[model samples]
Target: MMYDVLIAPFVEFEFMRRALAGVLTLALGGAPVGVFLMLRRMSLVGDAMAHAILPGAAIGFLLSGLNLIAMTVGGLIAGFTVAILAGLVARMTELKEDASLAAFYLFSLALGVTIVSIRGTNIDLLHVLFGNVLALDDQTLLAIAINATVTMIVLALIWRPLVMECVDPLFLRSVSRAGAPAHLAFLALVVINLVNGFHALGTLLAVGLMVLPAGIARFWARDISTMMMVAVAAAIVSGYAGLVLSFFTKVPPGPAIILVTAFVYLASLLFGPVSGLLRQMFPGRHLEA
Candidate 1:
């Protein structure tokens, strides 16, 4: 019965296998980036970036009608543009990145909606917004896998500077010339991951698999490494469980995966070993910090 519930879906359908693979690649890159975003308290900015990619994605959709390569490139261009513009605002002007991100994403969201309304039906717009994970092709899967690999490699290369920047940006800036580049590169990776994630999860909710696991991990883990691992593990579990549930229940796979992570977040919120709401019930029982 358990095998039928869990393994049968993937074994019975090629689409299920593709869906699982696609989300797995997304989680590989999304998890660590998510942990960092949470630690840096850039959750809102990250969310905005996800939404801000919509206009480019919409343009791609209009140009190619659900071509994965075109839409991904479009999303990448849009996401990176916003990140760079936001960073520039933070650097040159007095406006913060969060405010800049909010403004840009709102405009982009409006633009995307307008374009979609003018060019396509409401259902097409929904497909862009929510994605068609079951329709992922080999090319899309390969793109996601390549993005995940590149993200992991670049992260390893800049891990030290990133950690330093996160912990003590002023100190890192004073000590090494890598601080600014590290920050920019990290943002670039985020954009790339979001772009890839959009292919499976859509522009609006791509940040779900990324940010939610990180939030859940924060309550359970003390250090960054542990948090990242936990986040990835949680994300993978969510992907698997959500897929299984979706196969049986006929819910949308993308949002189901995200909902699984949401459930973990709720569990962590109330009963985590570290800083959970229920922790107060057992005073002085803090986990390793």
Candidate 2:
């Protein structure tokens, strides 16, 4: 039963193997980014940024007809542009970063959808929105892998300052100029990872793998390092379970994977050890001398 349920899918089908690889790679690279975003209180910003990548992707699709490289490049460009522009708006105007990002993302999402609708069919748009993980080709998988590798490397390099900035932004800024650069680098990593996931999970669903794992991890961990590990583990498990569910039920892999992660998030909310509902409702026994 286990073989038929889990092993057989990957053993029997090459696409299943590729899908598994794609999502697992995403889990390793994107999950930590999600953790940082959560720590920095930018969870909604991640969602905005995910939508921000859509215009570039749509333009890429309009020009190249679903070419992976084109869309990836387009997404990177759009994501970076929006991030920079929003930062500038926040810095130069009265608006805050979150509000600026929210406005830009909404505009970008609408623009992207319009561009795609202009030249592509509804099926093409659906593909952009929901992604087609089971259809990932060798080239797309390679791109995702490369993106993941870059994300990890850059993340490691900027770890300390970034964490400092997240924990105490004013203190970090007072101490060193690394704050701004680290912030930019972190945003770049976020964009890159989102673009990476875009190929396999679509623009709308891409952020799920990135953010949901972090949300689940928060209930289980207190420190950043442990939280990141837990997030990655949760993402991988969710990805695997989601893929298997999609295989048997014939549902879309992207949504299925995200839904599984969401379920885990809910469960963690209810039963996780660190800050679960059960723990809150029923405190542990303590002994006093």
Candidate 3:
């Protein structure tokens, strides 16, 4: 039963294997970014940025007509544009980060959709919104892997300063000038990962792989490093489970992966060690006394 359920799908079909590899690679690279975003209280930022990638992608479609490289570059540019603008808005105005992000996100989403609608067919737009993971080819796969590798390396180099910003921003500012640069660099990484992610999960769902796992890890792990590792593990597990479920149920792999991650997130919310509903249920016996 197990073999038929899990092993047979990959062994019997090359696309299944490729699909598994694509999502697993995505989770491995994107999960850590989600953790940091969660820690820094930028969960919504991922969503906003996801929408922000669309206009660039639409522009790419207009220019190259479904050329993968063009769309990716366009998406990267659009994502960064919105991210940088949000930062500038926060820095210069009375509005907070979330508020600035909200303003830009809505505008960017509407703009992107309008651009695509005016220039693209219904099928082309659908591709932009939902993505086609099973159709991911060798060139796209290589691009995703390369992007993931760069994201990890840059993140490691900036980890300390970035964590400082998350924990105690004022302290970081007082001690060093790296705070602003770190924030920008981190935002860049977020944008790049989201662009790469859009190829597999689409603009709307790409953030799930990053946000849900990190959110789930929050309840299970204490420190930042542990939380990141746990988040990656959870992402990989969910990705595999999601792919298997997709194989049997005929569900779309992207949404199936998200559904599995959603379940994991809900499970953590209910029974996690740190702040679960189950922990709340027996509060008297669970005290630190």
Candidate 2 per-residue C-alpha lDDT over 143-215 given as tens digits, one digit per residue, 9 for 90 to 100 = 8888889999998899999889878999998999999888888889899999988888899998999999999
lDDT of each residue in 84-181, candidate 1, tens digit only:
88778888999987888899999999998888878899998988888878889999999999999999999999999988877988999898999878
User: What's the true lDDT of residue 1 in model 3?
Assistant: 92
Looking at candidate 2, what is the lDDT of residue 233? 97
Candidate 3 minimal-lDDT segment of 10 residues: 280-289
TM-score of each: 0.95, 0.97, 0.95
Model 1 / residue 142 / CA error / Å:
0.4
lDDT (10s digit) by residue, model 3, range 1-49 = 9899979998999888888788878887899999999998888888899
Query: On a 0 to 100 scale, what is the lDDT of residue 252 in model 1?
Result: 91
Model 2: lDDT to the true structure? 0.93
Model 3 TM-score (2 dp) = 0.95
Cα-lDDT of candidate 1: 0.88
Which of the predicted structures, 2 or 3, would earn the higher lDDT when compared with the native? 2
